[model samples]
Target: MKAARRALPLLAVLLAIGAGACANETHTVPAMPRPDEPVEGFDAHSPGEARIGATPADVMRMLAEDGKPSPTEHALTPEERRKLAAAFGALTPLHRRVLRERLHSISFLDGMPNNALTSPADANEPHRLFHITFRAGILRENLSEFLTQKERQCFDTAGSSRSVSIEAGTMDAIVYVLLHEATHVVDGGLRLTPGSAFTKSAWSDRTLIAPAFRDPLLARVKFRREGEVLPIDRAEAVYAALQRTPFVSLYASSNWSDDLAEAVAWYHLTERLGQPYRIVIRDQGNQVFAYEPMKSPVVRNRFDALSKFYEEPG
Candidate 1:
């Protein structure tokens, strides 16, 4: 879950187009299977599935470079591929390998909103495919428009504008979306626990989350509008509500899966990358509200839980 802050040039641009870290966890699920078992009814060619959709030559190139992506007709420009590659390079070796092996191929699409999605592949294999599509082009001008002015400002209140992309000021934004969706692939594809709370395909269902996470905040954390547009006026009240909960971002406040996804992604981005995760609000040239999750007692507790998932021996 990412947003923009006060109108600083790049940040302000982000503010104008911010849409509160858009993600829709909906997927086609056939039936319940063992966590490690192959999901039934996963159609690669079906409109609903997450196939590559790249040209045959492009698919061959991707397959030759790395035998991952299954097949589709979608085309990715060199720059888009570079961004994806850079994002892939940013992951820890462990995560990178897991994604490379478990993920079939990464697909970029046209006219899709600000979301990176994943779906299981066909056959008996447990692997999955990844898809990324922005509301506009991948460039800053296009990507920045994903959200509105007010939405990005609300997000910037907690995020450091300096930490986004130095060149385009959009890399952090792109990386966060990649990692957030990748976390889901790890959860459902690899069968990891703790963070692997949601067992079903429906992304919003918190009923089956692991006891450790469910017992604590699942019942209390309320996503203002679970599936609809959230008002800009509600930003203040909603962020204030986040202060008391273990969730790190407003998007995390959406659902259990969303909660873990945003937390895990930000944990790596801020804690590991040594980037800023500071949140502050000013009134009449004076600071009124401030919080840095890594430094805050309330947020750090949840951070500790997320840390153990990666640190403890598996």
Candidate 2:
């Protein structure tokens, strides 16, 4: 018993030192802008962000130009298309190929999407649209609003002006978030492509919207299986997946779909982005990760597994 007691202090010291190293890694990186506060000149709709919302004729028209988009897409208007066309090489051959395949392929009706803001296909037509977004995870919100200014100051005791930092750990997490979010778009059962996609002939003047899904904040996210009840073990696995995502927090585990999407996004970024990234953050002792876009061990294994799944397509 005396020997064990003597060793306990030494073990505690080692643990404390290890944790310190992990915490400092996050504080070492830079900060990013809030999600809603997008940069003015920075365009996210680059080749990587390409989405298909154009009609079949419109898509064919772009194909004639060697896969450049046509002039008449409602969301990506003619001028924007011209400006973004090859701007960042907006529609690379890869993007064009994927866009074309999705447009012509009816296989989408076989799959269902979670976290879709919209449904599939025009109730009036067979055509459909897909939306995509990118994120650099910084999980801090304006806590000052919710907490007293003194409490906020207490949270920021690390003496940083901006609330968060980019760190290696979070960058590892981003690999998951990017993939998960992109999946919500590709999942085919989103808005504009719902179950009625094949039933356009059955359309009536009265459009039906699920009452629960009316608000964006309260939207019902789709999951791997449509309407399947998630057990605690499965739900925990999903959260573990998302906890590995670059931007998730304790709050993310609140729901199953949110957890799944977060995990998927993190897994994708770490693997598919195929670029080196770093991470650095100072949690102000909050225990949150800070990541720079640096290469990471934690992200690599998770991403590799996810990539295999996508490539094999079960």
Candidate whose lDDT is highest: 1
Q: Would you estimate the TM-scores of all the predictions?
A: 0.58, 0.31
lDDT of 2 at 289: 42
lDDT of 2: 0.26
Q: For residues 1-314, could you state the per-residue lDDT of candidate 1 as single tens digits?
A: 21111122211001011233443333222222243443354343332113334422322232221233333334656765566566666665545545554554455544333334444433234344333333224433322232232134333333322211111123335566666766665555444423333223223344343333333332332232333433333444545655665666655654555666667877787677765664544444455555555565655665545543355235
RMSD of each: 11.8, 21.6
User: Model 2 over residues 1-314: C-alpha lDDT tens digits?
Assistant: 01111222111110000010011000010122123433333334444434433333322221132334322323444544443333223222323433333322111010111111212222222233333321111112121121122112212223343232222232222223233433433333222222332112212211222332122221211211112223222322333343343223322222323333444443434444443332222234463343332133432333332332354223
Worst 10 residues of 2 by lDDT: 12-21
Local distance difference test scores for all models: 0.43, 0.26
What's the C-alpha lDDT at position 216 in model 2? Answer: 27
